[model samples]
Target: MILKDCQRAALEHIRQHSAARREVAQETIAHLLEMSNIAQEDFPQALSSIQSHARVALHFHPDRLSQNLTSVADLLLTDGLYKNQFETFLSNGALSPDKGGYRDLWENGMFGEVYMTAHVTPSDRPKYGALNLMLLPDGPSPRFGSCYFLLKPHVLPRCTFSSTGSQLNPPEKGTLDTLDGVLAALLTESFYREFALGVHNIRTRQLIDHLRDNLTKPFQDPSTQAAARNLDYFIEVQVHGPIWLADDVEILVADPSFKRTKTGMLLEKICEGYDIELFWHCGFVLNVEEVPLDFRGPKMPSLARRVASGTFLDVEMIGEAAADLKRHPERWRDRGPYEYVLQELKRLWHVLVKFGKPNNTQK
Candidate 1:
């Protein structure tokens, strides 16, 4: 089927399975459909005209959505601290905690910002948030890391209807690269948080083993860290999520004595402000794989844009999450709306180029 047709089918599925979810699903699917159309209109030869690094706009389940949120957070955080030696870098004033600032996805709904929120409450509101379209260039480069990523509230924004349509919301954009110092601090904290929280949970901690396995010479390459480009600015969208910190975060963070660094002190303060489960949502365009034309959405139902679910609120509930995943692994892989639109477009293009042939030599 065509890309638009696929979207139509998904919309129909949502309509039948759940009506209240129809509107938001419509909004998301419609927004993406419109973007696909715009890309084609703007480029004429959509796929080829599109740059490899072009900003593409685009969410998921609570256990699933929340997992995506954390992974995105990890992508931004780890990307920020990729090369810095975590050991004495902080004390050397290389990365100061005072640098980075957090933009609440709930408040500053901009396009292109690497952030996303999973509504743990309502099962179908809107999974994707605004993409930060502003690109002023901050420095540091993608080769350096997630310079602007910071931990903020995980709460979903209040859904409001506007006839304004899907204009790329570019929030106050100046420099995302300059926040590296601040992002380093949060990334440091996340590493430790994962480590500490994992000590009490098996599955969460197993993440450490995975990290350690991948630590040597790209062993963990498949587990995370997708690929790269010729320039140092080239970076692969690294896969990251909750993992057990069986050892100090220094293992992945590279900071030997992190608890004593200035970052460590700052992390303590940041943790005090929000509930323990709170995390910053990050969304960004990256060098990604060509998902299959027949890519199936994850197995879960759509999530409502409501409050964060209390089910996975505390570390204590980590066990519950593991059980949920173990019991029904299928639900965890439900195809997301963003993936559907993206892959379907590629599929549509393939179909046309193969059967809808035309002369290339100016007949």
Candidate 2:
């Protein structure tokens, strides 16, 4: 099936399954279908144009949304520290609005800024807060993170929509290089983060053993390997309800040493805000592998050339590569010669291209 057909099918599936959800779900999906149609018209080379990394995620909490007066912005405004990070980042100028501030996504809703030039990463310090910190955890260490503005429900879409660079280079620079790379990276990271969260639930020794097993496992099946080589792109439309802290967070808060620490204190404040079971309303992943690729490379940025011909890393390879970086930080630490810093930056850039299938396998 074609990319547009796949997207239509997924939307139909959601329409059939989303009756239990609030009206927000229906509204958001309708907007998405509109956007898809617009994309086809906007890009003449729709079959081969670089697929934009876009998704709409629904966020709802029963208690939080119960009162008609309790707006999303209101909740963030009143909620103690942790939940207010998004607001703090904007107000303090740590993050600025994108060139075009707010454009209407629909009659009632608007798409917000891209914040910093970079894509957000899940915090290494999960105990601190459920914050998706922007950029790598390098430099002066940004205190707050970037997330969607919590607009009120009536005037709000009740969803956050984001479009970011696939791969290419840091600060989410997009090019033909991101075509397959972006899709692979997003799916791999999502699954990896989810699995790592599972590790936090299990015993440390058991988790280590599991990782060890994963490390040792080889790509045994020929057919599976071939399938992995073929690239696919999809939008993971999802409705996430409520928010809850993990057990490890609670244990850490119990320790006086941890309680007094910065991350712990912030986490404690976040924990104080909400406690409920995790909920999700499934959407769908539409296959866009059939989309064509025929962009001119010479007109692209100089940096795009670097990623155009290299071997793109796989999911397991990315995990292993990341673990190696953590284990040996000194290799890239401390500034030295100009050439050395530039080389290290390039190396880090390659490491950061965390999406899609390897270029060698591109079909």
Candidate 3:
């Protein structure tokens, strides 16, 4: 069976099983059919099988549309803090706009700046606000980060702490290299998290665990093994917000650290081993208030006076500094400790990707 004939039959089955979902399924199937027609000559048996699969899908899962929407809403709510972080970064000029600043920014400083809103009541509609996150150079070097955020009343957030090289001296000279590395790392992490979220929804824990176990396995083919070895390392995490809902989480990336030289090295290594090409870009949305604020020292006052003043705003120092000490602790001791939450996220991703696969063994 030709691929197009298979798609047509499958779509017809969908149309029969779920009249309400026909429009949505038809549009998608049409595109697939068009692509298949352009690539293949003819295959009648394959077409019959495809139609059978479509029929099974439509009959077995009619509520998928609503479920998908709910899942997306949940992610947005849970990752509220991360969204806020991205928003703050973009608004503060820390990141550049790309594609006119659509939900997120691109590497070229262009973004569509899209906004979304939901109606909570007949008379009251709340705006979800805009997310204008994008990647921009941190300095003159090839160092960049995807900055993004979400907004609501009376909320201040901060971004998570991740490592990065020092800003470049002549920012323009290496902007492209830095932005590309950052974007690639961002995409890798984002995709990883997205895969996890999808898998978790279907309650596919065993499948997820299987994939994690295979991460260290050697490929039977040398070429495949080489490619896998060259792939870049990335960390994806679920950003939790104040909300307690299950779907209220967003995925974020933490690696590629905006270090151009290191990113280049990683890319070269991957290229040597695999035939794969990396093209996607990733952006993060985090709240700025979540980040700890920095404080300055007093100039004219004695060390004791400066310590007392710093303790007032810094919770970490309040208890320790209350007592008298022979030697004052360093400034870092007074501030909150840096925390890395990326590991927890990676675990979640490990689960989601498994769920994304088709149920059939043939997949």
Candidate 4:
């Protein structure tokens, strides 16, 4: 049968199947196709239509949990059209020996990783995910970060973060004093309870409130203040959370001297009795100083153009591809099929990026 026929049959089958079953089928097909020789361009219109229809149908489906899973998959497959390109670029960049396992650094001339994953539900199998937080001279620049929580469909609820943390250090005169104060304040009865309970909910707003309430208090003991000042730098806490389909949270600090081991230990102690994984990643900032002037074309655009186009899909794709490569490197052992997908994705990205740019006629 032709591609159109195949797609029609697939859609029909999906309509008849339960949401969970449809997701399993979709994932299986995605894996099979990843190793196939099919060209992406041949079915752009079809893919677009199927994805759109699936999205609407999923929203109205009876199985809310399964619908959410399928919706996320659909969005990953089609939404933010540039997602594929971003993934391809990041994958190639990360694996490139010259770039030293960093994708954004190689292609975009910036350094950072976008953390992501597919299996959000807690499983005995290693929960698939990625971490792309790179430390920079100015501080930690989380270009595109994501974390997934594994919870059943009926029990799952959407969560959101109120405000992100800043890398900017507080004033100098009070830097040492502030750091000491914040650390001690986190130990107060009220502060400790809020931090423990709020983090469990994995709500960004609650975390921020907990941090603000606890992190701003002054230290009363002189000995503790001295010890805090002796430390190289104060931990700058940036909160990220309320990830859909997953109970997730992240704390990023701007201090280059921040020790991952120490931070992890401290967090574990602070969160003693809480049931969550507190990951600690340390790396320097990866900033794109410039997009090669000549690189601006159908494939790559000026920062301004990219921003105007709002190609979030592309950014997401990069994260997804990166996560897949990290989680399942064995699946892509034969590089040929992966290369084919990457090239085709690049061509598509070029075309899509230029879809609506104003033509220059005053030459």
Candidate 5:
């Protein structure tokens, strides 16, 4: 998809103040245009179309939440695009590791782990909806960085997601108003209510305290307690990069780390209290390096094609596919044109970020 006049000007404006490397954004935009033939005017519909066909993963750190459960709104940048109190910590480079942003120390060299995690965690999942989160399995790898909230059709807009990542600056002050129709939904009171209620339902103070008490250190010192209370509020309604979910998306938990485990039991208890249906998947995803190529070009295998064509509606099919793969691991595992689907989907995501409504509001 080629960028329109307003889209081109928007990118140019972002480059002027954005901490994101200019070349990185430029290359991402160029690559996506080359990969997708979708028209510029069709981007909004294309955004929903791609996600409708893929599984979405919402990653989170359980231990960190256990310490101080906060809203997705709480995790946004305060400095660069949406200046507020939270960005104060980011600009000062005072953010803790668990909070997952860069300090001045490494801000120049690397993107925030929070944004990077969102990047590496592909929006595309197999038709069975199994996720290759950070290309690692469900156990205790640095890759999990956080656990996930897997859903079939995610609620967040594609325009909020960057195929690369966004830049975070210090106290620069920005707003989603520029993104117009795209992010205007985000700033609405209904959106704020959805976020607050969702987080409150998923992890309450009681749950946080329970998880914290179980932690080896507990972090109950007076100073830590004070900080936790202060950090708990939702000061600004902004998306630093991506807003992972809305209240309606069904939650799925599929980690061996959550199966028969203490945390898993607690999670189930929490879901039960909220009347939330928590589904499960086989705990592994078929991992591969790159997309497979064929005579016509790249292609996805049967299951992925089901997802891409928007026919993957039977939730039972998820378990069925998982069971078959488990029974015949040699034949059906790690052998698909999975990366091809991911690349094609990302073509839409990159276009959404560059020229879609949220970022290209000038039009």
Candidate 6:
């Protein structure tokens, strides 16, 4: 184990932050310990995705009614593109300690003891799912999303200010330049990231999914025949991007279900006569971490002092329905359930628009 003076000071800063939010801190530590192998260069996006799930997407009810972390975790799992990338990366031994010609910090760093004990609470044995929130055999159930390592300060290029939080600037210092300083910064950042991501994921899954689902109807088209046709426009969106009726066409058609042959055929037929030119802006996605996603978490003011939130399915024109309920709650004055759910869904969508950017691919 190696410790540099700057790393020690950074750890002290993290230790202080962790004390106030113990549950989040513990989960964050658990993430760090398990995912310590992720390379900083390839998958910094995972941190943003994880944080999105953890903090803004996850949820916490009143303490009296708060759900168990495992159950909450299960509900928020997403088998999206990031999940697939993580699996491929892990399966490829991309996270193996020996890959960098240096053993991972988790295996030999000063924090090795911390990694072993990151799972602080003695928890129930939840089997691992295709993906996981917790890394191993201890969680109550398997989940579909998770985190892994990013660049540590030791590997961080010198004098480069890292928004990744692996490099921290103390009150008296500009940035932690040495290996130890980076480690300290990494620990503190991971602690906050895990806790934040958990909360966010729960909120999005529980709250946002409902609105999107409610306002949107499931694929009820009975056509199951896979037909061959010119899927040029449909494929063009995949190759390009477009918006329709004020909604991003990609977002409207983002679900993989639309990828089915019949579904693809149906989409083409719907706009057979429309003249829509696809826009091409396949420029590299900005380094999102450098800008940092401003997901609604502890740092943001609450959207509602108390918003009644719920999930809905089998609804028609969900967007319109949600707007109706929000604009005219009195129309369903006797049906508070209907009105409140709509309002909640609208709020969730609002959060997504303000803070969530659509992915080009669903998974």
- TM-score versus the correct structure, for each prediction: 0.17, 0.21, 0.18, 0.18, 0.30, 0.20
lDDT leaderboard ranking? 5, 4, 6, 2, 1, 3
Best model number under TM-score: 5
Error of 3 at 186 (Å): 21
In angstroms, the error of model 4 at 29 is 51
- lDDT for 316 in candidate 6 is 16
Local distance difference test values of all predictions, in order: 0.23, 0.24, 0.22, 0.25, 0.28, 0.24
Candidates sorted by TM-score, best first: 5, 2, 6, 4, 3, 1
The digit string of per-residue lDDT tens for model 4 on 98-198 reads 22343323312210111222321111111111111111111111222221111222211111000121112221111111222222222221233443211
lDDT of 2 by residue, 1-363 (tens): 122322233233323333334244334433433533433232212212212211121122111121233423344335431222122222211122222332111101211111222332211100112111110111011111111212112211111111231111122111222222222233234334432221223332232234334322321222122111101122211111221222111111111112233423433444455331211111111112311133222211232322232333222222232233334446534444433433333333223221132223312
Could you tell which candidate, 4 or 6, scores higher by TM-score?
6
lDDT per residue (tens digit) for residues 1-363 in model 6: 233333333344344433444455345434554465433332233333322221111001100100122221122122111121111222111123232222233222322233224332111100111111221111111011111111111221112122221212221111222122222333444444532112222221222233223223322221222111111100000000111212211111112222333433333333232322211111111112222225333312232222212221111122334335545656655435753454444433333323322223311
TM-score of 1: 0.17
- Superposed by TM-score, candidate 2 places the C-alpha of residue 39 at a distance from the truth, in angstroms, of 29
In model 6, the runs with Cα more than 4 Å from the true position are 1-313, 317-330, 335-363
Candidate 1 wrong stretches, greater than 4 Å: 1-42, 46-53, 56-125, 130-134, 138-363
RMSD of 4: 25.3
Give the lowest summed-lDDT range of ten residues in model 4: 55-64
Give candidate 3's whole-model lDDT.
0.22
Worst 10 residues of 2 by lDDT: 133-142
Off by over 4 Å in 3: 1-25, 34-80, 85-252, 256-363
